[model samples]
Target chain A: MTPTKTAPQNDLPEVYIDDILMTLKYFTDEHEVHLKIIDPQVCMNCESKPCVQFCPVGAYRTQDGGTVQIAFQSCVECGTCRVLCPNSNISWKLPRGGYGVAYKFG
Target chain B: MSTKEKLTFDVIVVGAGLAGSAAAAIAARNGLSVAMIERGQTPGSKNYFGGALYTHSLLEIYPDLWDRKPPLERPVTESGFWFLSKDGMVRATVQGGKMQNDPIDAYVALRAKFDAWWAEQAKKEGVFIIPKTVVVDFIREDEKVVGVITDRPDGEIYAPVVIICEGVNNLLTQKLGLAKHDLKAHASALAVKQLISMPAETINARFGLPSNEHGLAASVMGDVSMGLPGLGFLYTGVDSVSVGVGVTLEALTKAGIKPYELLQRYLNHPMIAPMIAGGRLMEYGAHIIPEGGWTTMPKLYTDGALVAGDAASMVNALHWEGTNMAIMAGKAAGETAVEAHQKRDFSAKSLSAYRARLDKTFVMTDLHQYRNLSHFLKSRPDFMNTYPAFLNDALGMFFSGFGKPKKQLYKDILRSLTDRRPLVKAAGDMIAFGRTIMGF
Candidate 1:
């Protein structure tokens, strides 16, 4: 079968920054956010990383020199990479309770 | 924490499946003290589906869920509809890899693990979750619901509002007269599923998976139903594959065909057998799905109480959408509860907002759009009969090279169409199908 190319229509709004800021205040203390933010260099650069393309939310983006950066706040906890990755480098877990995507329509 | 036998909540949600957990999480996050009750050993243990979690509605609740470690089996990159006859398949597929990028797209999930995680999220938001406790009935006061009566000793937990997110076995909803006592078998479907264990490498090779990506295949057997209104599905899980068939109880009973036999035949199909070859059955289970769509939706809200999820029969069969509707309805109910609490009025009038919200959401909108489909498909057996065979025969003939002239082959295919169904009737059926099932 020929590979089908389709546009990704499900991009998250840049306003996600605001939603994350609000959810952080409601569900967690600033200390937790600070602790999680300490690891800015967590992404180990891999040539064939599936997360860059497989993340349903488009949360992973490659920056200058191929460094992988994740917008941690927008993660929905779908656990796709945890099971898909052959290298098993992705540490997957649910967002801190009461904090991530609140699926209104699941 | 005070276990003083006295605690009140803004909302009491029963059943911690997709709907219940979503309701509790959304309500509590809005700053309402909520209580989620589950009867299962854990949430999701009792729930199952062809099991795709569509993100459109879930995105409203968890906008950033795609970025998080979601409880997803595979990011579905390919979706197709298959009309299968004895030896032919008519297929239509939209190969949009970009469609999976939407944070709110669908995800394959197992209810057992997913529900537990959802319940935990609700609890983290201070939503008191009482698991292993069954809500026996709604505590009605003066013809209005006030709280719930649970199986727990001294388990009369009172709340101003209650939302029922129970799955298809809606015992309480029926008891409360919210829904009819006995549903028409046509309004429901009995699905028997098997989880077949297979090696990951083999699965990837068979289904053509790219690392974590997955594929879904749904087909309708022309004669497998034995003239019943139903379909079959095969979804790829991480280590196991889920295969099943669901027939309407009315059809199954009328035909007297055992569901297991139908499933066995489906598995034995030439096209399906090779895919599941060498796989061992790890689990076998059956469940009921509300196929009633919009017509079967009960009076959704009452004084001080609301009904959400499958309890309301909010399933859209056209796109095989359920879990997202359940979660969306739960969120809407939660928001309504917040509104009612703020006004200090949990009357049916105040809770009617839940209905209004559903109308605006895809749950009700999509169901209403396909409202006539279930009945249409039932009335027209061609969907399960002539169409699949036509597809199969046409393809079989087109691929067959018996040295027949191309002109004669085209004529032969046209003759086959008229032989199975009159051209006029087929055209009419196609038009009706497009209008109803396709939501045109």
Candidate 2:
């Protein structure tokens, strides 16, 4: 089923990522940028700002009443924020082979 | 010399996931030179899913890989489905090894480990692999397909044929004009999953498996997806259990629910909380799943190129059958590439033998049979929310057997069904369900 969104279900889970990242591994030359917002203006005008709410891991968050702030450090690369962005504000690229999160159990 | 001038290999397989790796292996094993290009540091590092690799297709591809102790969590010997409401849960179960003389041998292996291992097998069969490279576009010559252009300097790699298995979101397939550009939310489902660590004994005990044995792929529906036509899953790994939920992007946008909260709701469901109470959160992942089935699948073959796996919209949403389809389609593409090479024909006609193989297999037939399911689901969005919840309530009350007699209980359930919606619409949904499943 295409999952529906609102009931204000976004109470964040009380899990810590610092511990999780300790066990995970990766083999990239450096932690380079892979995801970027295409248009700052598009994000500023988004009323619903669906991308902020729909991302599974909260990679995106609201800054002030308008702008969007990104936390790429914990991004899981699910492509949810990119697909659900109502304003087409997201530009997602595949991380260079073996660049992102290394799943101990993907 | 430059990549353009140093042409080699007859075929280049793009992406090293299940489909690309399989295609590379299949073509190379048949004595054709193949090069597999992966965008991740390794083949499966960027790959993720709440998935169980169905062994039947893999066994057909690599009969020997199974006996060599491939990195597998466990053979899912049991399975369960749940209907969850606010305070109620209803479950249906299937637990056994043999079903009608055939074994249900699905193993819950992590994709990172499985794909990496599977690609090694391709390497063993003389398939060359280049990792950490992204195929930015296809190298077009005289309007026919040739090879791929990667992110590296002078990254153009040329060949007579190229197979695209770059997964659900890669734009290379779109650039090649094999698939529609800008895939919409309705065409895909979004998945959010977490790996939770626990003791192997604890996993077995909680999931009701024999000591030192594996568990089942447990899936639940109703409220977990927040009313989208989607479901939640709990898969038992060797020392961890993966729990998550998925919904279509359109549904997710309309409902405005966050994916993690839906996951939290599933984890905290009355039936699920106890199973992973003391576990540690190990990993989190999200990916777009192709759900358009057969009706919306892109063209399978074009001049000098073939597309397979999620990139071609080759997933069966109802059965959660992506990996199996990917492997089979990849195999077909490999064989077809070999045939095209032998005949020295790189046109769409030569590569279309892949389509014939797919049409004759379970992949295409099953997809064609269930093509209308996504639309039917959209028509009755309540199938995920209101109806399933009602089913739970009705069944709960009927079985509660408080003070009412059986006849009185039957009447109550009948009245309740009509109380929710117009009886005519309910009947239409019922008919739709039957017709969709029966493939009418």
Candidate 3:
């Protein structure tokens, strides 16, 4: 429960993405991946991986091979990557019925 | 889990959020067979909002709203703006006993509870609510929408008319080529919020609420979003607080800033840190808001189909109003559907009544009035960054000028204004401000 990191020059606590995601509830559809990269090569040719920064839940990450990896399990279903992707490389759809994030106090 | 029987209704409404439920409820009340399809396990399970619900819109659907005891957190007795700089803030709060009375203006609402209660009410009105079902696309016939295709096996549900209230992502609207493309990043925002739980007594004391029944709704601008065209919101619930930030996706992408990181920074702000210091995190959520105003709104009606709520980009962003707009639009759409049924004509020409009805209400008028606000804020970064900081600096110098000559203090403030921006830039701001106000 310790502060993951501290804000520079301030006493404010910096919370990690995982710590935040733990507060949410999700019913994952293990068989079906709702979010997919239409082409990994399209993502690689792109210089700026804005998805890593723009995703509110940090669902998109950069792998060592320079490909963007999607940790869709933790996605809050905000639909940011579907629209914000510069190359429109994301093929996004809602999770199956009774699946995906369910907010207890949304 | 699969049904071979044909399912049909007079009207099918996608989504069970504020707009969908309201539309279905009204359509049923008008004696039409209605079905509301929800993607979540329940109506509200997949929803998230910034926590304030205005009463005027809901009252139009249910006159006895407060009497039924909806799932309201607290009546908003105090609300206003907190213009923040990095180190200081200028707060403007409007509170009174009048706001605490019945028929109150607004309340803090948790969508998970509120939307569920709304669906229950819609069911009471004889609307069949299909839960845990996602509508994949419209069931089109002869270039007209006749029903919806859900994710379930053989899940084709038919109806004479379809109303799409499926929120800001609005894939269904795009599939029909109503909107040209997915909303650009600049037209929408990525908002992340955290619900921090505390005792009711603790919340009362921290927020200076008169009692547990009273609450505060505050909107913040300036350094909270790091000078982006965004806003920060804090709403007091019965025993929890909702604190969040919504930054334009365009700005976030351009700046390469993580929205959650910005939210963390907001939580620790000097002006904001103390309120929820020791509370436990209850839930974290995010949502997309349509901030494109009137200009970006898609065509509201087509043959045998109509769009309402965030699906039509019906958000009055400057006023922090969306649910109210959605509810109003839903009511209109429902009435229009009932009218179409009465005439036995479900053509594009007949469904155009939805837009005509909306045009007569404040939903369209207010949106038209504030049409330029989103564009104005996005185009001018200084309005979000430079002006608030300058106000704080000027006020800081003036307040501490007790020992100095008053005239000299006035002179210093005037000097700082010019030093912040050239005369031409200031004049440009004045003209732009006029245009934004006039909404040309």
- TM-score, first chain, each model: 0.56, 0.70, 0.85
Ranking by lDDT: 3, 2, 1
Question: What residue runs in model 2 are displaced by over 4 Å at the alpha carbon?
Answer: A1-32, B1-5, B97-103
Fnat for model 2?
A: 0.70
lDDT of 2 by residue, B214-254 (tens): 56787878877766778888889889888988888888878
Predicted complex 3: DockQ: 0.54
lDDT per residue for candidate 1 within B20-85, as digits (tens), equals 988898889999888898765556655667767776766777776656566777656666676767
lDDT of 1 by residue, A1-106 (tens): 1112221111111222232223211222233331121233444445554455444343556677655666655544333344334355555533332343333112
Q: What shift in Å separates residue B226 of candidate 3 from its native position after superposition?
A: 0.7
Error of 2 at B88 (Å): 1.9
The DockQ-derived docking category for candidate 2 is medium
TM-score between model 2 and native: 0.93
Q: What would the per-residue lDDT of candidate 3 be over residues B1-440, giving only the tens digit for each residue?
A: 25566799999999999999999999999999999999988889998999798899889999998687899999899999888899899887888867666778899999999999988999999999998899998887899898889999888999989999999989898888877778868878888999999999999998898798789999988888888899999999999999999988888887777778889988988878888999999998999999886877988989888899989999888778999999999999999999999999999999999999999998999889888887888888777777778788889998999989999999898778789887689789879978896777
What TM-score against the true fold does each predicted structure earn? 0.78, 0.93, 0.95
Return the top candidate by DockQ: 3
Compose the digit string of candidate 2's lDDT tens values, residues A1-106: 1223445344435443345445556554355777888888888887777766677666677887688877666666666776677776787876665566666557
